[model samples]
Target: MCGIVGYLGKHDTKAILLDGLKELEYRGYDSAGIAVLQAEEFSYFKAVGKLANLEAKTADFTTSGFAAGIGHTRWATHGKPTEINAHPHLGDASYVVHNGIIENYQELKNALISEGAHFLSQTDTEVIVHLFESLLNGGLKPFDAFRETVSRLKGAYAILLVTKQMPETIFFAKHGSPMIVGVNESDEKFFGSSDAALIGKCHRVIYLEDGQLGFVSRTGIHLEDAHAAAVVPHFASLPESKLSAQKEGFRFFMEKEIYEQSEVLSDTLIGRLAEDAILFDELNPSLLEGINEIKLCACGTSYHAALASSYLFERLGKIRTSVEIASELRYKEPLLCTDTLFVVISQSGETADTLETLKMAKAAGLKTLVVCNVDNSSMVREADAAILTRAGIEKGVASTKAFATQMAVLWMFSLYVAQTKDTIDAETLRKQIGLLREVPAVVRVHDDLHERIRRLSKRYLHGHGFFFIGRDIFFPLALEGALKLKEISYLHAEGYPSGEMKHGPIALADPELFTIALMPKNLLYDKTKSNVEELSARDATICAISDVPFEKADDFIPIAAHDHYMLEFFETMVVLQLLSMEIAIRLGNDVDMPRNLAKSVTVE
Candidate 1:
């Protein structure tokens, strides 16, 4: 994943571009660069590693006046994170900054090389700028060259191009990636991959549809449809906030987001739930009418959420359900029936594989829904309906609140379906609703709980490997817990259905094997306890979470007893998040931005 920002504004162009790139830092990158068309001449600076390095390298660079500019923060995909592989690659007549992969770059590059074009960096993006120049050299006009260059690209990209000849203009295109264009009261223009970079900088913003392309000049913004027809764009008013990303006195963004889970859940649940009724103003009941079965697809944390929701849909709605990883789903010969409801979950809603799967489902005539956090994402615009998680700006590369809110929304959705199907009696429905009402309270971490986790985290910092084991719905909870630990702590971890541990994985269980058991007293507690006893018999160090005391637990964090599993799920999620964060902190790892992980995976 990468970030792209472009501007033609009255304010210092350097400041605006750098500000936008900083706002997109949460997306993750290893190298950064910016190119400016100032005083009718192009100048650029490139640096590997953080934006700070780029800032330091360009400290004495001039920015008093500028015609146009583009910037990029790159997460290396095609080459090493060297200055030579950074963005803002220049061609004979163009300067370009790009995000997303260019699949057929080698073929394009070979053709360019054969034409006496000089090559430098080992990046796929450099092929784009070369192709633009190549097209221009063959007698194409500026816009023609732009469109022609884009037509040949075989993969995803949101490209911003500035021609030395047309220094007064900024040309752009998007396909299978995100791009937002905006303008100020002064007629100054801005472009970003997300609203976070464009907020407060522009009065209004237009989220470009895939294949939307055009230019911005002194007169105004222009538009071109995917089919090359001129059209007018619909713009939305920008919200009033600087959209700052601070720790809020917490050690890291992950810690702040972990503690904010209570309020995050509150925002997601507001006006959407009652004692015995579920309300989704954005959804029409008619859309749920012909759903004969359910199939859920997602990747990473969202996949875990979908896996958990499948259990709910099957148990409560009496519907047969299946869960698949979105990447695999796209390649397989999937049985996407018209009567089957297809659902996808993503935090950014721009996850490349999930979005591709959505497209496949749409083409197959399957009714689709997206459970996502961003209201202005591609999936929201493309899916039949969406349940916005409203968790608000999770800056951590490893998700916390996003996962929690997703589970919350899916739980209510499952209940709503059960009610419509008459699968549950009044008492069971009321109990489910009441359990949801208790979620916000249970996820709030008390001082006692945090301290207990912090003290016990030291014991876990040196484990050879970890087993997060549970059964039933807790199986997915175990997956999430293990994923969190592996993501932040950089430790080898696996989640298994407690019984499955005895199959082959239990052979690895030893004194150095740390087992975090989800022994919630609400669902199948006795069976889970039996599983933990087996692990204990093998001399694996055990950490049990439940109200009841565990005879074999080396450490214990007592969760409040509940009849419904969701309540315990909420409580156990908090403990798992805290445990992972504390262990990462003890190891001196960066909890907010984990190594080799981007917050939003916008590229495949």
Candidate 2:
């Protein structure tokens, strides 16, 4: 994955594009660059290894006065993250910044080579620039050149292009990757891979749909279909508050997001409860009748959310449930029937594997529902029905708030299904919904855990081994916590059911290892505590996360004590998120953007 930003305005083009790239650093990159048109020529600067390297190289340049530009921070997909491979990829007449893969680039490149085209970098993006140059040299207009070039291409792409011939305007198109155009009051325009990159700069934004192209200028933005039919843009305010983008004295976005969980969770639950304590109002009545089984398809952290959902669906809805990683679901070829309901979960809604999995289920004529953060991502668009998780912009590559909101939404959805199926008694459903409603307030009590987590970070900073163990619902929480640590912290963390420790994982336990015991105050509390005791006896330093106090633990992180289900299902997860951030920071890692990872996996 890569980050792309473009600007067309009165401000210094270089300054605006560079600032936008900085905002997108959390998308993860090893190289960055910008292309600005000045003095009737393209001026470019690029460097390998972080945006700061490019910034340092361009420190002496006057960024002001340029009218239009495009910038990119790249996560290498087809080539090494080298300075030459970074965008704005320059051609004879046009410069381009791209976000997705060009799957047939090799074939295109071979054809171009036969036509005597010279290549510089080993990137699929370079093929696009050369193709544009070829088309433009053949007398096609800039827009026409882009149109023809895209017509020949296959695979996901969100491209921003600027030409020396059309100095006042920028052209953009989206096929699969996410791109949005933001318009300010003065008619100046901004476009980026995510809305967060353009947040305060523009109050109004138009999300470009797949296969849509637009010409943006200081006067306004004009959108068109692939066939050049004029179209109106649908605008919306940026989902996140302006302040949420600011650190607000916090060192990182991860830390700030961790602290914002209570408010985020509360907002997610707003209007979710009905007079009878049913969770959601948007279920298909027919699907709720005689549901035979439930299948959840998700990837990465969302898979963990699904695992948590499986626990709740079985317990609260009294239904058979299975959680399958989206990438593995097709190969496994698990039985699917008309009576089976499939739930697809994704933070971006554009995750390539998850979307493909959802399509497969929909093709099978199964009832499909999507739980997603983005309003109209591919998965959401393809699903029969969907629930939006209003988690706002999660720019950080290592997810914090999104995971919490996913869990919250899943819990509510489970409760709703339970009510519709008449599996849960009315009073019991009411009590569960009541507890769900109180989660935000309970999360508020432990909001100060960040500092405590930071203090313990050094212990796990160089730790190569980590074990996460929990019982019942906490098992998924444990798995998710370990996944977070491994994702960003680069720790070798494994999550196991507490009861399964003696099965094998305990053999890895030693003084050099760290064990995070998710000992929630639940029915399995004693079993989890015994697992912690077993780790402690093996000379492992135990970090006990629970509402119940433990005597032999090295560290006790207390959560607000609540009913067994709520405690196991909700509060403990928050602490694991904090710990993931703290450990990442201690390792001198960029917790927001882990290396070699992208915020959204748009390419398969």
Candidate 3:
């Protein structure tokens, strides 16, 4: 993933671009660049490392009359992360910054070379600007050249371009990646790869649909679809709440997001509960009543959320449920029937593999439901029904609030299915709902526990490996915890069911190995503790995350006990997330951006 920001306005264009890039650096950090246009003058600056590097390069650059510009922070999908490979690639009379991959670049580059166009950098993005310049030289109009250039490309890309020919205009288009256009009261325009980059600058924004193009000038704006047909733009209001972007006194975004879980959980369940029943009116009871099986498909952290929901669907709804990673499911082509209900979960809702799988399920005539955080994401638009997690914006590459909100949404869906099928009694449902209401208060971290987890992080930061083990629904939590740690802390970690510890993972246990045990106060707690003891005997340092203290554990972090399994799952996840954050911070790692990772996975 990469970050892109462009502006067509009367302002300090360089300062605006830098500020926007700072807001969006969480999406990428490998390289940063900016190109600005003022009157007849053009300037470009680039760097190979963090946004700060580019800031230092542009420190003395003035933006007095600059009114148009584009900037990018790249995650390095294609060339090496060097200044030469950085974005804002310049052509004959234009410069461009891009996100997503240009799949057909080699073909286009060869043709451009044949046409006497010389290359400057080893990047697919350079081909785009050169192609545009060549087309304009061939007497094609600006819009026609852009449309033709897009027709020859074959992959996800969101690009912002500016040319000397169109000095006051900014051109932006996207195929599979996310883009938004924000307009202020002055008719000035802002565009970015995500809403986060435009949030504070403009209150009204338009989310660009796939295969759409827009051109912004001081005069007005123009939008068109893939076929070049003129289109009307719809704008939506954005949340200006300071909490959306500020650290709120926290040292890192991972820490602030971890603490935001309390509010995220409450927001997820807001209007979905009745006095004694869970409400999911989106699902037709008559349709789901006859469904015999449910399929949950997702990728990365969302896959773990689906794995945890598999247990809830089976136990509560009395339905046979299966969980499959989206990347693996397309090749498997598992059997499906009309009675099969397919559910896809994603935080960005634009995950390429998951969206592909969702399309395949729809083609097979199976009714589909999607649980996603972004409202108008491609997955939500294509599904038959949708459950919005309402997790707001998660900037951390290692997700925290999104996972918890997904769990909350899935739990409510399970209860709805059970009630619709008459598999659970009303009294039991009421009790569970009551306990869920108390989850927000229970998930808030205590001062003592926070400091204790912080202290425990230093011990394991230097460990050779880590193993996370849990039983029942907690098994998925174990996998998710391991993923968070490995992603942010750069440590090798694995998760396995407690009963499976002796099978293979136990053989890797040693003094330098660190083990995190998820022992929720459920019926499986005793068996999980027994697994921890087995690790202890091997000289492995055991850290137990549970409701009660574990005497055999080398370090213990207690989660508040909850009578219901769903609430227990919620609090257990919060503990592991905190531990992951603390360990990454202690290692002096970039907890938010992590190495070789992007906030959104928009390509295969």
Candidate 4:
């Protein structure tokens, strides 16, 4: 994934672009660069690692008088993470900053090489600039050349182009990747991959749809479709308040987001409970009327949330439910039964594979609903109905509040579906609602919890990986815990249903292998204890996270015992999140922007 931002205004172009890039730093990047039109010529700088390096490289080029500019924070896709392979890819008289892959770049590159076009970088993005340059040299007008270059390209992209031929305008194109453009109070046009990148800088934003190509000049935004037809622009009010890349008082975004879970969960539940019914006013009940089965699709943390929801859908809704990894489900040619409700979950709502899966389901005439955190994302627009997670901005690449909010939303959806299907009685509905309402208070854990976990983390740095095992819904929580550890700490970890350990996983259990067991007393308590004992018999060191204290554990992290299963889920989740975060912190890892991991999965 890469971050793209641009400016077409009379302000300090370099300063504004750099600020926007910082807003997007949470999106993992390997290299960064910026190109600005200064003194009738393009002045550009590129750096290999981090935005700070790029800033340092361009420190002396402080020209507040630039015409237009574009910057990119690139996560290497078609090239190594090298300075020369970074963005602001140059042509003869233009520069480009791009996100997403160009599938036919190699073929186009071979053709261009045969035509004697010189190439500088080993990135698919470089082909685009060269081709545009070639088209311009062939007597095409600047705008015509831009369109021709895009017409020759294949695969997903959200591109921003700055050319000397049109020094006042920043041309852009969107296919399958996400891009947004907006203007501030000064009539300055701005561009960003996500609205978060332009939140504080812009007054209103226009989300560009696929195949829409246009430019933003001092006049205004000029957008058009592939057939050269003018399309009416849709603008979203720029949201107000704290989406800045501020960790508040915490050391990192992950820690801050973890601490924000209580409020995040409460916000997600607001207006969700009205009288006795679990009301989702946005969704038409007709979609669920004939739904015989539920299919939950997502990737990574969202996948774990979906898997956890699968258990709840079955247990509470009395419905047949299945979880599909979005990436795999796309290639598998999954059966799209019309009677099934297709639910897609994504934090960014722009996860490439998940978006494609949702598209496929729609093509097959299936009713689709998206559970997403970001409003106005691709999936939200594509799906028939959407439920916003209300998690605010999750800048942490490892994801903290996003997962919790997604779980909260899915849990509510399950209850709504249960009531609609007549599978839940009045008493059960009230009890579930009461438990749902109590989530904000239950997740408030032990005061000494973080300090104690910090001390416990020191003992786990050299373990032979970890086995985060649980049962039922906790099995997915186990998966989430392991994912958090491996994504941030670079340690090896695997999650399994505790009972499935002896089938094969238990063989590798040794004194060095650690097991973070989720043995909630409210659900399958005795069975979880039995599984922990089995691992202990094999000398596996145990860090049991439980509401009820367990004497057999090598280390016990006590959580407040709750009568409801979801409350226990929230309590155990806080422990696992803290434990993984503290371990990564002790290992001196960059917990916010984990290595090789991006905040949003914008590319396949």
Candidate 5:
């Protein structure tokens, strides 16, 4: 993933572009670049590191009298993180910055080379700008040339181009990646990879849909489809203060997001729960009645959430359920059941693999439901029905609030389906719904363990590797915990079912190894405890996160037991998140912007 920002207005173009790039640095930080047009000439500056390096190199450019500019923060998909591979790549007559991968870049590059075009950078974005220059040289109008170039392109991209030929205007397009147009009170036009980049600079924003091309000038912004059909733009207001708030006393965004899980979970379940029932008016029970099975698809953290949902859907809804990783599902010849309902889950809603899978599911004649946080994401627009998680802007690369909110939504939906099928009586449903409301209160107690978790992190941070063990629904939580640790802390961690430990993972256990055992005292507690004993016998350090203390564990985190599955799940998740955050902090790593990672995976 990468971040793109541009401006077409009277303000200092350099200041606006640089500030926008810094705001979006969380999306990516490997490399940064900016291109500005002053007196109809392009001035470029780039650096290979954090945004601070770019800032250090562009001190004079910020004061230059530029009319329009574009900037980028790259995560390095096509090439190594070097200044040459940084964005704002040059063509014969223009500069372009891009987000998302260009799948057919090699073929396009060969075609351009045959046409006598020279490339300066090892990036797919360079091929695109050169193509634009070739079309302009072929005697096409600027708008028509952009349209044709996009038509020939394949794979995901959100591109922003500013040509010397059209010195006062900025042209842009999106296929699978996200792009937004923002207009301030002064009618200044701003472009960004996400709305977060436009905050404080512009409030009124328009989300650019896939397969759309547009241009912004001092006069106004105009949009059209790939076929040149005119498209009307719809704008929504985003409050700057709410989105751009300062981290109040928190060391990092990950820590704040981990603590925000409770409030976000409450917000996610707000209107959907009642005294004795859960309501999802968007989900037609009649459709669920007709479908014999359910198939859930997602990627990364969302995939773990989907795995957790499959257990809930089968046990509570009394339906056969299967889970698939979106990336793998797209390439395989999956058995498409006409009677199976497909549910796609994503936090950004623009996950490329998941979106492609959603399209495939729709084409196969299966009814689809999407669970997403962003309201108008491509997945939400294409699905038959959608459930919004309402988890606000998650800036941390490792998701915390978003994942918990997704679990809350999944649990609510599962119970709703079960109630509709009469599998769960009214009284049982009421008790579950009541326990859901108390999750926020129970989660608050996790802060008491912060000091203890920090101590455990100090003890285990130097271990060779870590293993996370749980069973049933907890197995998915185990995977999520390991993912969080590996993403931020850069630790070598693996998650496995407790029963499977003896099969293969047990061999990796030694005194240098660290293991986090989730023995939640649930139905499978005894089975999981047996695995923990095996690890203890091997002298591997064990940190048991449970409702009750275990004498054999090297460290113990005690959470009060709950009969309801959701409450116990939420409590354990909070503690595990704290552990990861503390470990990453202790290791002196960038907790918010992890290495070779981005907040959203727009590229496959």
Candidate 6:
């Protein structure tokens, strides 16, 4: 994934573009660049590292004279993170910045070379500009050249192009990666990879849909289909404070987001339950009639959310459900039908694999429902229905509050669906909903565990392996806990069902190993406690997370002893996420932007 920003307005182009790039740097930070059009020429500057380096290099320039420009912060998929692969790929006649992959770039490069076109960088994006230049040389307009060039390319992309011939306007299109057009009170137009990039500058935005093209200028904004048919724009107000993108006072975005769980969970559950203490009204009976099967698709932490949903649906709703990784589901070509309802989960609805899976499921005639944190994402627009998680903006590469909030929404979705199908009685649903309302307060009790988790991290940094064991709904939390440790700390971690530990995972236990057991108080609590004893007997250092302390465990991180159906689900996750962040910090790692990982996966 990469970050892109384009502005056609009265402000200083370079200053505005750089500010936008800094706000969007969570998307990518391997390299940065900017291009501004003044008169009939494009002036460019680029660097091989963070945006700060590029800004230092261009500090002496006069960008106030230029009225239009585009900037990029690259993550480098097709090429290495070097100066040569940086964005703002320039041609003789135009400059282009792109996010996503070009699958047929090699073939296009070969054809362009045969046709006497020169190449400068080892990037698939360079081929795009070269192909556009070739079309312009054949006497095509800038808009027509972009359309023709895109018709010949294959794969996912959201690109912004600026031409010397059309210096007053910027052209952009989207197929996979996210792009949005914003209009300010001053009537200026702005475009960027995400709404956060243009928040304070422009409050009203039109999020681009797949296969849609747009032309933006200082005076107005226009959108069109791939074949040039006119289309309308949908505008939405920006969040209350543009400071949502700022870290405020925290050491890192991850830390700030970890503490935001209480407010976000409260917001997500607000206006959802009625005064009669029932679930929301949006999940009507018509949506659940004869829905025989559900396929949950997601990636990374969102995949863990789907697993949690599977457990809830089976236990409460008695429905047959299958959880699939979104990337694998697209290639496996699984069985899908009109009777199947596909539930796609993603923190950022622009996740490439999840979006692709949703497109394929829709094409197969299955009704799709999106569970996401962002309001106007591509998946929300394309899905038959959407349940928004009010977690606000999650800037961390490793998700904290978003993952917890996603589970909250999924739990509510399961309860709503069960009520709609008449599988669960009204009294049971009301009890569960009441418990859901208390989750935020329950999670707040674990806030004091931060220092304790940091102390626990020191013991596990040099340890060889980590084992997380849980029973019932806590199994998903165990898996997610292990994943976070492994993803950032580079430690070997495994999550297994407590009963399954005897099968194979027990062989690696030793005194140097750390075992995190999620012992939430449920029907399976006693069985999970026995599993902890098994690990302790093998000389494994035990860190037990539960409502009550166990004498056999080495350490106990106590949570609120709530017997609500979903309260333990949310509390255990809070402790796990805080533990992972502490472990990462102990290893001297960047908790917000992990190495080699972007906040959004916009490429396959």
Worst 10-residue lDDT window for candidate 5 reads: 239-248
Q: Pick the candidate with the highest TM-score.
A: 4
Clashes of 2: 0
Better of 4 and 5 by lDDT: 4
Name the better of 3 and 4 by lDDT: 4
TM value for model 3: 0.96
Summarize candidate 6's per-residue lDDT along 1-604 as a digit string, tens digits. 7999998877798888999998888899999999999777778999987788999989997766547789999998988999878989988978999999999999999999999999888999999999999999999988889889888888988999999878888988888888988888787778889877887887788888888887887567778877788988888887547776667897788888888889889998998876334455555556666688888999999998899789988877778889999899989868887888899999989999999999999999888899999888989988988888889988988888889889888888887778767788778887787788787887673435777777866767877888988887778788999988887777889878898888878888898888999887764888888888888999998989888888878878877778763677777887888888888888898787777888888988
In model 5, state the lDDT of residue 333.
Answer: 90
> Candidate 4 residues 265-295, lDDT tens each?
8899999897588989889888797899999
Worst 10 residues of 3 by lDDT: 281-290
What's the lDDT for candidate 5?
0.87
Give the whole-model CA lDDT for all candidates, comma-separated.
0.89, 0.82, 0.87, 0.89, 0.87, 0.85
Please provide, for model 1 over 196-288, each residue's C-alpha lDDT reduced to its tens digit, 9 standing for 90 to 100.
888888888888889888999878888897778887988988776863356778889899999999998999999988777888989988778
List pairs with backbone clashes in candidate 5: none
lDDT by residue (tens digit), candidate 2, 1-604: 5788888877777778878888887765789998887656778899998888988988887755547888998888888888778888888778888988899999999999998898889999989889988988889988888889888888889998888878888888888788889887777788888776797788888878888987887567779887888898888887535666777787777777777888998889998877567556565677666567899999989998899879889998888998899888878876788788899999988887788788788889898999999886777668888888888777778787898889889888888888777788888887887778787876663536766776877777765588888887778888898989988888899888999988887888787888898887766778778878888999888888877899988888877667756744566777788788878777788877787887878777
lDDT for predicted candidate 1 compared with the true structure: 0.89
Runs in model 2 with CA error above 4 Å? 63-66, 217-222, 227-230, 239-241, 279-291, 330-336, 445-454, 462-464
Ranking by TM-score: 4, 1, 5, 6, 3, 2
Cα deviation of 390 in candidate 5 (Å)? 1.1
Each prediction's TM-score versus the true structure: 0.98, 0.92, 0.96, 0.98, 0.97, 0.96
